[model samples]
Target: MSVMRVAGLSGLILSRALAMTVDFTQTESIKKGAGEAAWNMVRYYTGNNTGDTPGNLPDPYYWWEAGAMFGALIDYWVFTGDDSYNTITFQAMQHQVGDNDDYMPQNQTRSLGNDDQGFWLMAAMTAAENNFTNPASNQAQWLALAQAGFNEYVSRWDDADDTCGGGLRWQIYTFNNGYNYKNSIANGCFFNIAARLARYTGNTTYSDWAEKIFSWERGVNFINTDWQVLDGAGNAGTENCTQINGALFTYNAGIFLYGAAHMYNLTSSDTWKQRVTGLATSITTTFFKDGIMWEPPCEATACDTDQQAFKGHLARWMALTAKLADFTYDEFMPLLKSSGVAAAEQCSGSPTSDWKGHSGTACGFSWLKNSTWDGNYGVGEQMNAMSVIMTQLLSEAAAPYTSTTGGSSVGNANAGSNTNSDNLDPAPITTGDRIGAGILTTTIIASLLASVVLMIKE
Candidate 1:
């Protein structure tokens, strides 16, 4: 009995070790996992240039969701140095853009919303920044497309309105429901693209536009004193009607965060630094439960498709801020790491989950570590999980493989050396995590007990 007990205990320990051991050192593997997930999504949603079939995306296929998925693929290519997906990226770009590949027509592209157009432009900007070589054209062509997109936004800026003084409308279409809605997402996306373009091309025009947009947002009180970005105000028939809507969203925070990070990196001004830190603090305090992030309105119930997709931008930009801004990295790493690990654990047994670095299905939508899936698995869910995994993998790639004492290190490698001393582990483990560990132990023990009984009978 004593020997059986020891054997069972050993089995349990092995199971725990297997469960906990994720290879942070395997950069290629990590990139491949993320990249493949994006690839799988593209295959399902996007098809060959042979024209639109029942299986393929229809002609002029440019929407916010499709743009985001394409952006994820481009990010995967840039981060991993894998060009295998570049052909697919450009193929979609060809389908969406005008004949010159620079002008994205509102009619042809069906880009009714400024925010929707911004998403595609941002992906183009990323490709230009990374110098993604196109077989059909050059990097200059990609830059031209980005500039055209920017020019489109500049043309659409509604300075004539007295409500916010100056800001873009949610939709360029007059008949759209959100036409009267001056949303943060529109301005935030505009701000981010402007900042990124400024950094990429060293164009003061882009920076100036970014500054103007930021001021407009501040003026409207959409971005409050606490750095919490409210949703937006609409029906502003007059300046007196400038009451800002207070509903918060994660993507709004994310867009501003990344935009501010870029501007800070560009100028290194104290003001930008303060803005970056203030927004970071607000995001952590407001959106996170303990250390994991949740969309507040959607926590109790399943998030709508768009809301379900919102958190991915937050995850991506927060991680980007950590990578680009040294001052905020320490502050942001704890939540990023904890949430990332929890997300990974929660995703262990997801439908079509390809966790073993092999071909499988994409990850599920809910990222609350243990939240139940809302039964809507689509491109958005795939993009969200891909973004998080890519961010975590990049964090791992930045850390040293081994410690000075040669001791096996745990936690996020980029999370600084004196983690304990820094008191970064403020996150309380979720009950789900504890229950998950307990289940693993019980399963291993039961299997070992059955084996021991068989031996005794023999």
Candidate 2:
């Protein structure tokens, strides 16, 4: 009996030792390096550098890619509390929203897909939550734009479609490309934004929408019984039943996981918890091989521009899940930390450049790719690397981000009311606790080519 007791005590001691030894290396150099990489990508976008263009969409001013960059900037701000990019973030938001709080669908030649708009909306929602500074005229108005976007989805909900039993279509109009597809990303965005709105406003309507979206996804088998989230169904013709594409993209699981986390946070319901657990488990078991999360198709060579950007979203939400959901924190922390380290190490330790002086390390798309960038250094790659690093820093720092006092008044209080069917006001964009720009812009024109882009097919 004493020997057995000693063995049990030894096991307990070992467990405690391992718990205390969680490997978290959040160095200033590492964080600063990530910030520089992000800025490098931003400079590339503005046409100030000649390293590599974003993707098939040569127009640097594309809204969705810009949204991804903004997301990376937000993560950096949250992790380091550095306001270096505050002006850029503010300016980007200013240009993004139209006079009526609607996102102007202007991306050069490419038609604005629902997922593209949804990405910007998701970024706006993040800006609101993190107390990021906005234009004084639009203070606290991020939620209003978010609501307007959400309302747009609510209105566009095609209940008449027998194919998927009512979900948002990928394209706004039939004239635009991808109109026939009902994708995971489009519905996932709806679920995510609705869940976030529910948390922020404490409104049941948003929760109801969240629940309904999840149900539809489940009913259509897009989210399988095992919780594997497949790609969308192509609505090419009304004659064919909705066919599940079955390609497991990382971002699909990402938004769904985040939405589930938010729902659990807002409602404290066991169902949401179960959903969160199931989804996390599915992502862990189904998505990852050899303990590294990867989008399946691009495991070998370079992923397409869109798929190249997908893993960043997965990393972003996985970190969020670790932060927001207690059930998954313990499980995700080590994975995230290790993944971050692997990603950073894979980046070229020194910057590369041509004779014209454009210089930066291209982070390889695959985390498993332990070499320097063999492909173009576009917006997606930069965002993906920055995202992984910043998430790691934030997780290690364990900062508490509280909402500021003056910015709570959403431009449209009726956003949650579901009654303001009319035009949305030019909501508040107030300033808050943010860093002043007095420091320096020495890094702005440093001339490095970092990477950034998406998949066309549903």
Candidate 3:
């Protein structure tokens, strides 16, 4: 009996020791840990597996999450220089761009919220920004695909009809729940995507839309006096989107921070720079406890799968923000580095027979306990854990490319303009379009090269 008791204690000790296995400073360690975490996260994706469809996740996992997954996978590839998952990521992304080249794939329409579509759109945007391999020259180019989706959202901006003045409603379809709520997240994503598009395209229209969205959010008090972003206001005609939900979410904070950072980068405006600083300060104060990020509303209470994955988005945007607005790199890194290392420690989930016989390093959810796995595992948990760890690899990464930079994705400024009642994409990208894009790229490169040559001659 004593020996059995001793064995049980030893097992518990081993389970608790699962964390602290990852060293954030070492490139190889971070890559190995990120690879393992990514593998575990992808296991939840049966949608594109042997028995499943090409770009979807099976049961209980929503379509929006698949986009989020691809976004993280893109980051994973960029961080570690790994191409193992690129094929699957590419396949899944293309399969979901819908007929209009927007992310409104037919399969997800019934339950698709604006935020859902936005997640997929942002993934395409990420692909364009990072210059992730473009699809077949015959298929949609990344930037054009993103522009197509951005155009669709611009059309959907609810200023004229909605009671919230200018905010996006939570659900796109009226039949869906929360259709009346002009959620902060919906607008936050729209703003986030717009800012990125603005920076990538050098188009003032995108930046102007981003400003309009930011102004609307502030006007409605969704961004309160403290710059702490609140959840959506319930908008049932008379309710007027005024009765605020008064809840905070980490993803919202991250969304706002990243977008503001882009605005700062684009215009070098003090106003945007200040907003970025405020948002980062609020993010750290509200979400971080002892240097690790956490969800205040749902972490202590139970979080649904959707809530579980929120931190990954926060970490993702924060990393991107740090890169885009180099000024905030110092302010953002301390916590990012701490949370990342803490998260890495929890990657050693080797569950024994006493632990339900799980055999891999399944990532845990909570990073509060020192070197202790929280004993929970899922796609959300895995992604959240890996995201923070992968962020540590940022030190080794180059800033993302813009159209004027080395970015190779071809774009259409007007991809998503809906001329038909069916909302079809304006037209398929033609050979002429590709040639025009090539000429544009060549011109930009030539101009840059000429400037360099002139400088050398001088």
What TM-score fits each model? 0.74, 0.78, 0.86
Best by lDDT: 3
Evaluated at residue 413, the lDDT of candidate 1 is 16
Write candidate 3's Cα lDDT for 57-157 as tens digits.
76567888889999889988888898888989999999888887878878788888888988888889889989998888878888887788677776666
lDDT tens digits, residue span 122-232, model 2: 888887777677557634367777887788777777654443557877766544545556778899989998898777777777888899999988988788888988776
- Candidate 3's TM-score: 0.86
Off by over 4 Å in 3: 1-14, 17-20, 351-360, 419-458
Error of 3 at 234 (Å): 1.4
Clashing pairs in 3: 19-345, 20-345, 47-56
The segments of candidate 1 whose C-alpha lies over 4 angstroms from its true place after superposition are: 1-29, 53-62, 99-103, 106-111, 135-140, 238-241, 348-362, 369-374, 395-458
**Position 158, candidate 2: lDDT:** 63
Clash pairs, candidate 1, are: 352-361
* Each prediction's whole-model lDDT (CA): 0.61, 0.64, 0.75
